[model samples]
Target: MRKTFLHIKIIFCSLVVFSSLAQSASFDCSKASSDVEKKICNTPSLSKLDEQLSEVFKPLKKQRTFQVLESEWLENVRNTCESVECLEDAYNEQIGFLSPLPLPGASASNEVKILPADKIYAQSSRPWKTVELAGLPNGKDVVERFLISAEVISGILHVVAFEGHYDVPNSIYRGSLYEYIDRHPIVQPITYTIAKDIGFQGAFNLGNNEEGERYAGIMGGTFYYREKIARNQLRGMAYKVGSGTQPQETSLLLQQWSNTFENAKSGLLFQGDEVFGELKAYYPNTPGYETIAPVDRPEVGWNIFSPIWSKSRPVLYFKNGDETIWRANVVDKTLTKIVSASDQLVIKNPTPVDLNGREAVVYLEDYILKIAVAPE
Candidate 1:
């Protein structure tokens, strides 16, 4: 009888320890003082989520900007949650943003194809040599969507494309950003959520200022968002441009006016006012302001959305209509059609980059991304 009683006591102690461990969170459960902390300690699922978040957020804490943002999220989002559901949603959203999702058709086994001269439409004397970079897998939902932006920085190809799934009842759409290095499988940098109502407006560009700090500008209809890109990760939360009674209109107007410039070396340049028409520059890093001389604008018919500036020449490339890509000589203000494709396959978002010693341009033809090297 004594031995049986001792065994029963041991079992009881084991159960008590297990229960306490199950209820513990990333922090000490005994020291939990606030309501949110107490709630997290008491609930098993919340405890597990808190532990998981702690693990994921551990490495990112080294980044000072991320540390600041994490504190802000804890106070603003997590602390504000009154119920378990809200807390769960907040945790999941944060985890998703921190973790990257695999790009839809980024496969290592895919081969790059070279196109013959007849397949490319360009001037006879200056025929563009083209090669297929990567393409989406054959699917119905990915048919209509196109690549949004591409930029080559320090020999790495950075691309952003529109990804969507069309279902009868619930459709989803978002932008996917990835990098291609040395023809390897595309690496997904990060995943982010877009506002449901506004959505991504198919305009994204990455540029560097004179200081060599990289910045990304994305247009989501009424609002144009800007954020810094550091260590191949989006550093912090994106902020909207413009303010006033009609902020949305101002945002788009500012974005459109800035597209006239070739690069963001001096930051985003836009016209100050319609009456004065003086050019102004806004540096996002310092939030500083300055005035500059006006730039030569392309003729009225050119679509000035996300034009890629040539690093070697005074030329800028932009998409015109559904089938044409035009190169503008900023010195002479002459527009030349450098690429033309079938109406069924839209030519969009021309990006210029120097590959080794050769100058090349990358653009989206339908769902496939193709790079064309300028003739030597």
Candidate 2:
């Protein structure tokens, strides 16, 4: 396993205000990994302290156990904090301790490293994966999801993450925020993640949900995503990722290449933006079509160049939640259910010639649905 080490030493800022200098620490900005290291490098005050700490650590380096103590201080005191200010305070506290800071957190006990004081202090900003949950507007889902794990005081949906479904790690948590845009159903996809450090737990206020029910603990630092959301909405993703019942399949990858949404009463069929393949659909049985925007293109008027035959007959298909498919028939312009959602089904758009025979369906990931009449 790899290890990281740092020892903070406080220096009189006045002495370095006007002196030509070199780095006092072993590491420089070029070597820093965590966000905290970057902050120390960028800020003049923190840089001076880091350099001073390096100088102090040099003399102590001759001592057998000094390096060990420095390592302990890093894990227990420094890594726990999430902000520059918090880190600065941690350094000052360490400065008051013996040589490399007493064992754990600057405690008066001679027994260092033996206590449970070793805790991560601060950290740099973390990278997060964006998960889009659609149709959830009121922020209720977010509350419900995290209510048990963390204390959700509830203002615009605030939470302190408790160990959740082992799937989400401690280093990560949902940092959340919400707002209305373009008034299109106010489908504000609240950006959120579980906070790892205490530094991110602020910018809070009492706010209300879609129902106007007031909540508490809504914090700041989640505004970077609004522009992206706005851009998506403009491009026709009316049903955005929200805190609601999202799609079972997260495969609707947004691409400028070629994806098409066909809204026939039979259902909402979506062809993956493939210049050549992959079809998906949300049938009439699936709710929330009213939530999607319409296209000027004629419905069911698309031309099908190829027809996938189940044996001389073109097939029309519908997806049953990510898995399973259904064979469908259009009666009086409405889809009548034939075969239910199943596996190994293949379907493609019905060609003008095959429209009179039988209508069926197949579409989803990895395979192209071909529905052209077989050669006579």
Candidate 3:
């Protein structure tokens, strides 16, 4: 998540040694006179305050002092959960059980902390989809609700797609098992043809066109998707949200036939019990688009929420597709999720970034939107 200047100040205080009384017992809410004061004294509120204070004083609390880099653990969690949820339903029937899987290194007491050096949040497992050049029995070649990585060929993007396979008797699904390679149109001569003079050496943009119908310039090109949208493009490729920015992204193309391209533009999410709706473009200035006033949707109220924001990107940009809720970045050259949403639309492009454990997923349906990962 984006580290506010206030957070930096808090970090500074965390590094120093304070008085014993300063670190003593908390206030008693039962004896508080005011509701606000009493609320602050309550268990959850008190705990939050303590955590906030501790975070601010982290630098001082630790014996070894080091640099504090911003991370987006919340964004990571939200995007990961959303993306996995997209396919969770379908995969649930295919798999044998129905329970949330624990993240790597997750324990009862210890929570995953976001570090600056962490390029991605999670890793890919076995038993994924297959990528191939020729058509399979289904003949569609492209499979929905999955993750894959491809390299740039002689000016083309080549990715190996695979369906996750379960080992019989063992009852374990080999995670992210390689399937086959699928190739789509790419710019001939690749990056060299576009900018021969510039020294740009990076992976080929094997992204889907997400924001092609609306939100002009918001999403485009694999490079733009990777840099601007980041992991949200995975959902875009999956066709969870919308395709306002680019259509080449995976998800957007999937939704093209449905013609409900602006699914991610504005929507609501029910997490546990709370409901959140996007408000970034609630009142749009552009013509041809109807403005959704808060009064019209009192449930959303005036405080329309956006996805979590990180140093790199926003979470809302990655829209939810039919089977993929939020296709996000597990790390470089890899993606992860549990499929479920057969009708959910996803915008291609618009990805997420990790900022101090705050996770954000961006999805551009008619407009760029996001969803934040709730605290553990």
Per-model CA lDDT versus the true structure: 0.48, 0.29, 0.26
lDDT string, candidate 3, 164-196, tens digits: 233334332222212121122211211121111
> TM-score, each model?
0.37, 0.21, 0.22
In model 3, what lDDT does residue 292 have? 25
Error of 1 at 309 (Å): 2.8
- Return the TM-score for candidate 1, rounded to 2 decimals: 0.37
Candidate 1 displacement at residue 187 in angstroms: 11
> Between candidates 1 and 3, which one is better according to TM-score?
1
Best by TM-score: 1
Q: How do the residues 113-221 of candidate 2 rate in per-residue lDDT, one tens digit apiece?
A: 1112232212122211111112223333232122111111111112121111211333222333222111122223333332221111111211101111112221231
Candidate 1 per-residue lDDT, tens place, 219-278, comes to 442223332233232223232321112212222222332334445233434332122232
After superposing candidate 1 on the true structure, give the runs of residues whose Cα lies further than 4 Å from its correct spot.
1-125, 143-149, 165-175, 182-259, 262-306, 332-334, 342-344
- Model 1 gets an lDDT of 0.48
Misplaced by over 4 Å in model 2 are: 1-26, 99-376
